[model samples]
Target: MTATTTVTTTATTSAAAAVTGVGVVLPGLNEPGGLRHGPVAGADPVDPAALIGKKGLRFKDRATQLGLCMAAAALTDAGLLGPRGLLVPGDRVGVVVSSNLGNADTVCRAVATIAEENTGALSPMDTPNASSNIIASEIAIRFGLRGPNLTVCNGVTSGLDALRWARLTLRSGRADHMVVAGVEPDNDVTRRLTGARMVDGGAAVVVSRTDAAGAAAPRVLLGPSFRTEKLPDCVAALADAVPGPAREAAAGLWLGPDPSAVPPGGETADLSGWGDCSGALGLLHCATAVAWADSGRTEPVYALLGGAGGEASGTVWIPVERAA
Candidate 1:
C-alpha cells in the first residue's frame, strides 16, 4: 500500500508581505485571456524577443532569458520602472530566483566540452551562464536591482523557500521590494533528468511592505511564516505558531508541487497542466491566488510544498481590499 500524507493550514504572527504586482511567462499565461485560465494546451512558447526585445539575449540561456522577461513584466506592472529607469533607487531593490533545473543545459554542455574536447574549447560567453547564481545575478544586473541578490536551488521546496526568504529580507529591512521569480526551461538536459517534457517558462511577482503598495492596487498579505517539517507535523507546527481563524477561512484552497497526497477531500488543483514546472510551482501558486483575489475571491489560500525527504514548506495568503 502507498503511504498517504495529510496537509493543513494555520496562521503565524509575523508581518505580511504585500504583493504589488505579478507576471507569468508560461505558454498560455502571457497571452490575452491567459490569466483567466493558466497554461492551456498547444499555447505558443514564450518569445523572449517579443516581451523583452532581442538585445542582450544572445549569450543568455533559455532559462535566464525567460526569467529576465518575466521579471521585466512584473517590475513594469508594479510601476517600479519609469521611462528613464527604476523609480526607486537601484540600491533599494532585490532579486530572488528559484529553479531546480535552470541553466542545466548550459552547465552540462560546458562539462561535456571539458571532458570530451578541452577546457579551452568552452566558449567564454557560455561559461558565465553555468554558474548557479547566473539567473538571479543577470536580473539584478540588467534591472539595476543592487540590493540583495540570491538564487534558490533547493529541490521541490525551492519556490516557497525563495518567497520565505524574500519576506524575511523585507521584515529585516534589507530591501523595500523583493522581485521573486521561479523558472524552468524545456530542454533536452532537463527533460532527460526528470524523465518528462518540461515547461518552457515560469512566473514572477513584486512583493513589498503593505504600506508601500498603491492604495487601489489589488493586494494580498503573504505569510511572513515558513515552516519545514515532516508531513504529519506540518499542520500542528504551523497551526500553533499563531492562531485566530478557522481552517476554511484561513485557506479556502490548497496548492503545492504534489497535491496527490492531500487525500480526496478538500479543493485542490494540479500543476501538471503547466508542465514539469518543478521548483517554479510555488511561485505559480502565489500568482494564481493573486488572480483569484483580483477576481474578488475573499478567502485566503495556502501553498504547501513537501520535498523528497519528508520535509515541507508552506505559507498563507489572505486577500485584502483593493485599497489595501
Candidate 2:
C-alpha cells in the first residue's frame, strides 16, 4: 500500500516562468529523431569531448561535461547564445543543476587517495571537482552566467526543486533568465550507491519571465502549484488547485517509478524507461512536456513527481497559444 500524503498545498502562483527552449543529452535523445519516440535501447552514449571539444574538459567531471552539452543546446535553441557569447547580458542569466551523484565518483576517489596515499598525492587539476557545487559553478563560469547559481541534491525532489529554485529566482527579479539542467552519470560508485541502472546524460530547459522571452519562442508554464506529500494526496491537491474546467483540460506525465501512482487523467506518459535518472528525472519530465506542447498538443499537461521518500511535486505546462 502507498503512504498517504498530507493534503496541505504550498504553491507559488506568481507569474509563470516561460519555458522557451529544451535540450536533451540522454540516450536516444541526441540522435536524429530525438525524444519524440522515447529512449531506445542500444542508443549511442553521450560523447562530450566530441560535442564540446576537449580543451577545458581534461579534469572536469562527467556530470559537468554532460551539463554543458545540455545547457548549451537549450541556450542555443532559445537564441540566447551566439558566436561571441550570450545574446543577453551574462549577469541577467543564471544556472541551476540537480544531480545527486554528479560528483560522487570524484569525491570518492579523492577520499580514497587521501586515506591510502596522502593529501600531497591529490591531483591539482582534480581538486576543484571535489566540491559539491562544481557542476553548477562550471556551467555558470563557462556560459558567463553571473547571476544566482544554485545546485540541488534533495533526494528525489531535487530535479523539480531545482526548477522551483529557478522560478523563485526569476520571480524575485534576481535574473531575467535561468538555465536549468538535471544530469547524472552512471559510474561504479553511483551504481553501487543507488543500486540501480543509471542514465549517463541529462535534460535541460531555458526558462525566463514571459515578458523577457523572445516573441517567437515556444512557451510553457512551469507551475503555480507545488506540494510535498504522498503521491495520491499530492495529485489530489494539484487537481484541486486548478479551477474546474482548467483541471479537466490537462493531461498527466508521471515522473516516478510507480505506475500505480499515476493520477486519473485524459492521457499520461510514464517516463521510467529513461532508467534511473535519479534527481535529473524532474527536469527531464518538464523538458519532455514542453517539447510535446510545442509539437501542437492543445491540451495543457501536468508533470507529476513523487519520490520514495514521500516527497511529491507537480508542474503545469500551458502551451503558449493556450496560455492567457
lDDT accuracy of residue 300 in candidate 1: 62
Summarize candidate 1's per-residue lDDT along 1-324 as a digit string, tens digits.
986555433234546567777888987566212443546777688889998889889999999999999898788888897667788877878999999999999989998999999999999999999999999999998899998999998887788888988887877888888999999999889989999888788789888876664322536778535565575455434434334553442345567634554433335656666678787888888887787677777656667777646788877676775554
Model 1 TM-score?
0.88
The model with the greatest TM-score is: 2
Across residues 268-304, which tens digit of lDDT does each residue of candidate 2 receive?
A: 5656667788888888877777766766665556666
Give model 1 RMSD, 1 decimal.
4.1
Judge candidate 1 at residue 280 and give its lDDT.
87
Query: Which pairs clash in the backbone of model 2?
Result: 5-230
Estimate candidate 2's RMSD in Å. Answer: 3.2
Single out the weakest 10-residue window by summed lDDT for candidate 2: 249-258
